[model samples]
Target: MSYSEAREMFADWGVDTEAALDKLAGIAISVHCWQGDDVRGFETRAGASGGGIQATGNHPGRARTPDELRADLEFAYGMIPGRHRLNLHAFYLDTDETPDRDEIELGHFTPWIDWATAQGIGLDFNPTFFAHPKADDNLTLSHPDQGIRDFWIEHGRRCREIADGMAAAQGGEVVNNIWVPDGSKDNPVDRMGARRRLEASLDAILSPDYPRERVLDAVESKLFGIGVEAMTVGSHEFYLGYAIRKGAALCLDMGHFHPTENVADKLSAVALSVPDILLHVSRPMRWDSDHVILLDDSIRAMAQEVIFAELTDRVRIGLDFFDATISRTAAWVIGVRNMQKALLEALLSPQAQLKQAEAALDFTTRMILTEEIKGLPHAAVWDEFCARQDRPTGLALQSRLEGYQASVASRG
Candidate 1:
């Protein structure tokens, strides 16, 4: 079917295909760099990833160097339909020096800024809170020992410094995200003490004044983790209160919550209180699986709420998943394209009429219309979007991904 016909069909449902396309085009999905190497960073002294995080699979052609990862990302970016941001971990530094986490300097990431500048994209950053020796007993920022806590605080400060540097070079706010694995496997007798230490540590890290335009500091929370099966010091409540009280952005990872819980449903509630929040879009088989995102019902619901609340500017969307089972480039391409597709579908929904129906207490009609709109010609609109972006639509990019895997990824 012609795109014009699909647009007309959508218009009948009070959906603006043009506006949807425009909005989708403007939404920048933050592509994660870890997928290219199964969360392995190109550090001078890289080690195993700890902090209750692990990427499974022995996929060959994993990018083993900074240049190789950049090449893979460049190829992945070409297949994606929009200009997007890249998310980087502190471990991905391109320095010859083996700087400790607290000693990491801006020079370490100068290469990243250069690459981002050339690509015309911005970069988000995260502190490497795990896999370090100082992270003894699965705690860093919240470690009971004062010296240990100080080390992590310095690391956080340095991360903010690097983020600010990147922003100065790239001309946008670099989101400096901090996620820690500070908890106990068994129920802790002194939960309050641990949380108190965590709060103090965070206060210290964020005490220094940095340009808000240059960097936006955020903290992520996890419900539970591998070793910290019983208690997570940085729980949802902890980060939620911290974000609101401290005036920082909170990161909501889709796979971080319980299997039955819907991170999408929490959007409005969080938006109602928090000024701005970041989203770590991912898929979970049962827990925090970090499966690559797809255009699934959960994703659709989240996008719907974002549009419904008119919180596009307030919400920063980013992809946060890594799978070593598939071609890294293909993983990036699929996750990003699916994210865009979900947002596009959300924009194409008959939101105005649905709201009116709900206000009028017409639940039956609302339900019927909701199910019916699912069958809309969204695919046609998406194809037109791909064409407009000068990208191959649908499965047309399959051969390209395969060819890149053989020709490019094989070299890694």
Candidate 2:
């Protein structure tokens, strides 16, 4: 179905039109170096090669021209319904200057930042290759060169600096997200160099050098294999738990775990160990590489929905992916809406009902305390909860799930 048709169908289902609109509006896309229209064969090719192998475009070829790039950003902005901001990755900036430690140099590309500001959206400066494997094993912040170490440390600091400057420039708060694409294969243990580097980076981030309260440093973890190429923070719990011990919060990427890992249980366990949290929402697939699938894929979406259905207000979901097609933008927008629908269904699940039944275990204990409870005025919470439901609600929820299943089948 077309995007508008899907919206209309959801509206017709007694779904609050305004809420659906807002949720769709709340959805934003992250532009990887290759996903836009300006670059030829961009979706397939690795991005422009200048500063590094996976570095941002430079010198303005026909595909990487300034005007074309701007147009692509505008196109992405227009696709998001209203008042929503984009989560920008920093791989697009030309790193020709390689600025000094304390310098406030805005690399070769300022127009992208300017454009995002004008659109009433906040941009995440210093975006990293957190999802890609190359940045994990091949890169390091605390290398021998002072310039590189300074650049890495300065990059973390500058995200806060740019956020303040951007907020002043655009009149709003900007978000700072950080993830190290670093770890070893055989020895997943963080060496002195890795720990010191991560500590230095986090210290710069959490420093009072800028108003630290104004920014958020989301430390994203990854999940990979057992080989030398396998390096991610997801399995390296000690390192991640240590970071949280030293004042950094975890950004739990949904795609970054094995099928056996219960995401809800993981969150509960991690929350006990760590005080703060940020969530990265994506569809998980069973593979060694990152598979950027839509959120409605049942095997992936079910676990996420089950966890989030009972969520309080603390969880914040950020959509992360390297869009491989023009249709990916609209697909993601619809995918988020579909995931919410599944979450609503999951909330109404019989298993959850059973858990609620189990919560009444305390009711028996309270009843044993006093026989006067029977005579006194008391309300039946479970009866009232059951009273609020009917055959229609059940059918409606079942129909929605079946509809989602049918939709996935058709796509396949």
Candidate 3:
């Protein structure tokens, strides 16, 4: 279908316009947009002795009023609803002051848990305590804040304390999505000990204290620069395979693997290694790591080929993307669209033809790709969205999308 016609049909289905664009390309996404300090109202505060509304002397940091926080939560829900989920990354709090356990509970973290419970929105908890850049001399699991061993131990202790406590008190589960940003120079000789340190860290975090059933150690991969930082778990199959052997499942980030990595193959490998697995969906761009864009037509086609080849009911899709300005709600919409498109594309392909081609792979030594020209029924849902793209369809999808993106300083 043409873009405009496809967009029109998508609007009719009640899908957000941006979401339609994302889905057309293929993928499932859960948008990560922080409710920044600005919107939370970090301006002046009531002074001591009731003097007046004066700024705090020491920059008390921005605090979201209950109303503001609630509104943002509602706004996010309205956009993505269910299917797409939200992950509370440590960075989003927008604070350098390490939050105490209680403050962490009170801030967006607690409210988010409460909100998710009420809204039935799935929430993933990321407990990444140590920063990796400082480990320049040697591959260390320790944070600069604490001794290498001490930091690793303390982080696991805290994670267990928080996770166990919440799982018992809260009704829903919390996923301890672990993505350690660690590594050092590319010298294979010096890097020999890095994986061991990483495994040690995971061993502590994934212990019985943490809810293994609910927790997902999403070993995120990063593009390691220089020689100090080793790339994330994305490139190291052995690291992830070991995690599977240790009883903790795998967490795959779509963007972590670059031009050379195949997401479908990664997914299949993880699935075969472990009984249960979780996934993070994002677009990988050659220009950068974590570009957080959609697949576009070509990538989408490739993703479809992958899913058709290896996807199983055991694997679950999560919308994981970083959007600075896009509202949480809009991000959710885009994610859902991407996921639906990916799956639909897979389901609609010529499976029989694909299977036949696979059989011939042994003799022909060529890859077979199944394709179809039929547009999905859901394409019609975008009519209202298309109408509103240039004008107003009584829904401010564009304005809201742009507004959220602007808030995060995200361009395109």
Candidate 4:
């Protein structure tokens, strides 16, 4: 199946394959830096992985330093088509002087800014609210102790500043996402108390108003984690209301919800209230395992909803998974490309025809057209996309990945 044939087929259904490719090329997925290093950021005072965050595999060639991680990211980006952004956590700061999470300054992240600028890419940020001694009790911003809550609040404030600096350096806005791991292993008597403290802490952190064009704040929620199974402080309902009231973006992590829950369904509901949305595209193996994403129904539905509802500008997509079992760079390339593929598939959908059928109350035509769309030559169009970007597809892509894996096997 050639691209021209595929294009003609799509055209017969009132879909423009060329326009779809152009849109796919413009959509940038914020590739997470943590994936390259198994979420082990370069903080000198880094503690043991805790707060429900754990990267399980001992894949050799794990990036041990900032430079190594950046090198791995560069290689992954080469295989992935289109310009994208880098999602950096606060702990990933690269500097000689040691800085605590609350004390981190933009100087510590200068190297990353410089790298992104040179690569002609954008930047995104996250405040690391886990794996610290203060978070040992599975609480940070919502901790019972006022002093402890204040400390985490300051960390959040500093992260926003760093995000502002990054946006200034890149000459664009940076999505500053906040996800706190504040929950009890068992049911707590003071859920309301903890939530109140969290609300106060967040208010304090967001007090200093940064320019919206430079720093786009987003709050993420989780259903449960390793130890916080009983109750997560930042649950979906909590953040949904908070985002609506605070005028911030609500982050919907694919792995943060129940396995049976369709994250795609929430897009339209939340879009009605929140100013914007930030998606953490991930795969959960019965839980928030942070496995690399595949081009499965979950991803396809997400892409289709964004396109079908005309919410492209309101939604910001980013990848969030860390699987150290495979070649780290390969994981990145595979996950990002899958996301691109899903978006392209959605873009090629005969949306006008589908909507017309639905509006006319013709369920049979809608169902038939949708079923037939699955048989379209999407793979041919995908191949053309990679070819246009000078990237390999099919067996060639696999061969390149194997060669890179072999090259990195020698890394200590």
Candidate 5:
């Protein structure tokens, strides 16, 4: 069906396609930098990735250097509609001087700030808490040793400062998300002690007050990892309470929760307590596998909740998946576009009509309309969006992907 005809059909349901498209254009999905290089940051002292993070394929065109990653990102951004931000890690710092995690400074990341400024995009940040000798035991921030905890605390502090620097350079606020790999594979005798140390370490790390407008602190939690199956110190309940007490943004990673749990339902519950939320939009096959996002029911439900709860302003959407089996750049484009598609579908929903029916106890109308809206010509509106954004749609998008992959086939 043509976009005009689809528009008329949506209008019959009291939905405005134009407004939906406009809103979709404004939402920026923070594309992760790790996907370009399969999470291998350019740290001189970089260690093997552990803590349940594994990017399993050896795609031919894995970005080898900072320049290559940035170039790949530029190419991916071209195909993706709307101006989005880049979520950077502290370990991705590009500089001549080799610096450890704790010693990293703003100068090391100045190139990224310049690049983001040039691209007319904003920056978000994360402290790399895994893949180091200190984290080899799967303990950081919550380590029993005071000195060890201090080391990770310093790293977290520096990351927040770097985030502040990024915000100052880009003239916007930067979300600095902290996720630790502190858990035990076997059942621990003293979970309380570890959690106490974690809380204290976090307090120390957040001691230095960065401007709220420039730096927003967020804490992420996990259920389990490959090694840490017995217990995860930074579980959902721990971070939820901490965020409420600290007035920090709570990060809800789609892949971090249990398989049976619905992240969409947690939005409203957490929204009531936390000041802001940072979402790590990822797809989990059976575990926290970090698969590339698809336009699936989970994504649609999450997007719908964001719209239904009127939590757009309070939520920051960011992608967090690294699938090395495919073209990395293609992975970025596909995942981001699917996120946009989900949001667009949510925007095009006849929410007012459905809500009105539910309020009036018209269960029959609500259920019928909800199911019927699924058959709407969403693809036609999506195609129109891509056309207006100068992005290829349908077969053209696939052709572009093939061409880009072939162009980068010689990467060694």
Candidate 6:
């Protein structure tokens, strides 16, 4: 069906397709930089991927240098239809000097800020807490050794400063998220002590003064991972309380939660307490193995939750996954387009009527409406969005990606 027809059909249900498209266009998804290079940043001369993290597949054309990564990112962003943000880890800094995490300064990321200025897109930052020598035992901020903990604390401090610089460079707030793989492979006897140390370390890292308008601080948690299967230092429960108390943004990584737990359900719960939250959208297969996102039920539900809670302003959407099995550019395009499609689906839904049905306890009507709305012409609206944004729609994007891989990526 034509887009106009679909828009008219949606209008019958009190959903303005144009308005939905406009709203979706404004919401920026923070695209992860690690996806282009399989997380192999040139920060440290580090070894293999460790700390309960692994990227499967050895897809060729991985970004080896900063220029290559930036080129690949631009290629990926061209297919995506929105004013999206770029997410960078501290390890992704472009520099000849392999400075330690604590030693990193804004000068190291000056090129990145300059790039962002040229691209006209904002930037996001993350403190790299894994795959470093300090994380040898999977304990960083919560380490028993004061020196190790101090190193990570300093890293966080520098990360915040860099985030402020990025914000100033782009004239937007940089969401600085901290995700540490600090835990024990075997159940430790000092759980309380570790958490106490972590809390104290976080307090110290966040103690430094910075412009609140420039940077937003967030802490991410994990259920468990390869070495830290027995215990994780920053569980969701731990960060929830900490975020509530410290007034920091809580990062809800979809893959970090258990399989049975719906990350969507926690959105409203976290929104009610925290001032704002960061969403790390990634697909997981039985574990926190970061896979590319798709237009699946899980992602759809998460998008619906965002719409239902009216969290367009309170929640910042970010992509988090690296699948090297396919073309890195295709992976980025597919994941981000799927996320945009899901958000479009939620935006085009008959939310007010559904809410009214639920309020009146009209279970039968609500169920019928919910099922009925699924068959609406969301695809038409989505294609229209792509067309409006001047990006290839559907199968057209695939061939473009293949062409890119054949011409640009394969040579790289």
> Candidate 1, residues 1-412: lDDT per residue as tens digits?
9999999999999888999988888888889999998887865444534777788887777998899989999999999988999999998999888888899999999988899899988899999988777774898888988999999999999999888989988888998898999999998899999999999999999988787778888889998998899999999999999999988988999988999998988988998778789999999887999998888898888888888889899888988888988888899999999888888888999988899999999999899999999899889998999898788865679988888888764554
Q: In model 5, what lDDT does residue 259 have?
A: 89
Clashing pairs in 2: 136-181
- Poorly placed runs, candidate 4 (over 4 Å): 46-49
Please give the CA lDDT of all the candidate structures: 0.89, 0.45, 0.47, 0.91, 0.92, 0.90
Clashing pairs in 1: none
lDDT of 2 by residue, 86-120 (tens): 55444454345543333444544466567776766
TM-score of 4: 0.98
- Candidate 3's C-alpha runs over 4 A off are 1-30, 33-70, 91-108, 130-146, 186-189, 209-212, 223-235, 295-312, 323-332, 350-353, 356-369, 374-378, 381-396, 399-412
Q: How close is candidate 6 to the true structure, as a TM-score?
A: 0.98
- Model 3: number of clashes? 39
TM-score of each prediction: 0.98, 0.60, 0.66, 0.98, 0.98, 0.98
* Candidate 5 root-mean-square deviation in Å: 1.1
By lDDT, the candidates rank as: 5, 4, 6, 1, 3, 2
Model 4, span 51-79: residue lDDT tens: 77889898878898999888888888899
Model 2 is weakest, by summed lDDT over 10 consecutive residues, at 376-385
Number of colliding residue pairs in each model = 0, 1, 39, 0, 0, 0
| TM-score winner between candidates 1 and 3 | 1
Clashing pairs in 5: none
